[model samples]
Target: MAAGIEHGRRSRPNIRIIAWAGAAALLLVPLVAMQVTQEVAWDVTDFAFFGGLLLSVGGAYELLVRASGNATYRAAAAIALAGVFLLVWVNAAVGIIGSEADNANLLFAGVIATGVAGACLARLQPRGMARALVATALAQALVGMVALMGRLGVMSSAWPGDIFAATGFFAGLWLLSAWLFGRAARA
Candidate 1:
């Protein structure tokens, strides 16, 4: 409590406010685009969904991050959050499998569920987070393996390769997050 302010963090004014405002501004883009073109038609439900997602992401960051933690920890948290955010966004929008409408896409949902459940189990501790993220990486890869073996998204271009690539990319991100968390634990 030196100088009645937290150290390690830069004394930047309105950073949290700016982050929330920026998130709100992003929602405006789609709203403005809908006004600009008929092709960009987005209903009220779409706006609600996106708004909810952004709020949840921001809220999660605020809740899970420890401001006093080391840079490695912060980086680990950011990487994990971004990875999860992109995973949910891509899965919801186009899906890693054939399309958003495909039943196979449901598998990706489990990957997210696994991570959330593991995070709960770990209580967000660094060592436990590292293990939880490893579990998440495995879950991500398992979804891809299932899609490959089950011939999911066969109608899509490059079939198995796309599944492999997408799943591999996400799994790699999870593994990297896990590695970072592990390093943070060590430090």
Candidate 2:
């Protein structure tokens, strides 16, 4: 029993490090792609940075929820995820993040709505919460694909690459969130 406890203690940090590294890689891929393609010049407000931050936060939330085994932590994580969606929407609306044509506002609004609905469902049906979270993750992926296709100079000049990048970044984050939440549920 003592050996098992000691082994668990030693393994926790390794698990966290692996999670962080994976999140960093996911966040960096698109940014590197953008820089290589010259789609946009690198800047501080780049989507990769935001993506990394969101992933880190989501991962941290998961770790905390798992460690504490607290429902409140899970609820807070859900709320924080929703807040991130809302922030993206606001950024798109003000033209601070994406182009006018990207329609980030609408995409983010849908995400926010879905996230809120998922949270509500989670409260009512804990057993199916993971499914709701997974659905939100997929929705984010759809938004990313739309944003990406609309950008890259495919449809029109109105499409914004920044918005596409943001969506893609958050989609990755949501994927991480779903995995973490699912794992927590299982454990």
Candidate 3:
């Protein structure tokens, strides 16, 4: 019994690492695509968005895991990530951040939020981390789907090309997350 417990303890970190690595790989897809396309197909900001999305997803996973472990931490990390997503959506909607403009400020905010979320998760529920990771990834995927639909000229009036582009990128991230989470849950 003690050996079984000890073995379980040793495997937790590996699980987290694997999940993180999967998330990281999903995040890198756009970057790799852009590089391979010679930057002619996609802009640098496109890659940046994927990077930010990865950070946000990874952070959420960490936060959920942390919260699961330490019931005292007050689920603020997850809430904060939600807020960041809202901010991005609002800013993008109001035209405060142009579709084509490379806005580092927004990206920076996202990064910070992700970092906080990750730290919180690391401290909290490391075991149930997959659920949180999946949730974040799903959110991103939804955003991507909306964007893809727009790009396909589905919602021309409501979402502009830029919005569609952003959404499409996130959608890819989320899909990857879903796969990872599903796999981890099964294992």
Best by TM-score: 1
- Tens-place lDDT per residue, model 3, 1-187, is 5643674564245666886788678766656776777744646775577567667656765756654443222233334344455446445434322432434225434433443464456443332333444455455444445445535333335545555555455444433443443443444
Tens digit of lDDT per residue, candidate 1, span 29-146? 9989988889888888988988888988888877776542577877777788878878878877887899878889888778888888888898888788889889999999888888
lDDT of each residue in 1-187, candidate 2, tens digit only: 5644674564245645675677678667767787678764556666655675567566645654564454544653655455464455345434423544544446656765675587577762333455565677677667667656655334444456555666666666665556655665665
In model 3, the runs with Cα more than 4 Å from the true position are 1-13, 35-40, 69-187
The true-versus-predicted C-alpha distance at residue 73 of model 2, in Å, is 5.4
TM-score of 2: 0.46
**Which candidate, 2 or 3, has the higher TM-score?**
2
TM-score, every prediction? 0.88, 0.46, 0.34
Q: Best candidate, lDDT-wise?
A: 1
List pairs with backbone clashes in candidate 2: none
Q: Please say which candidate is ahead in TM-score: 1 or 3.
A: 1
Which residue window of length 10 is worst by lDDT in model 3?
70-79
Q: What are the lDDT scores of the predictions, listed in order?
A: 0.83, 0.57, 0.48
Q: Report how far off residue 39 is in candidate 2 (Å).
A: 25
Better structure of 1 and 2 per lDDT: 1
- TM-score of model 1 vs. true structure: 0.88
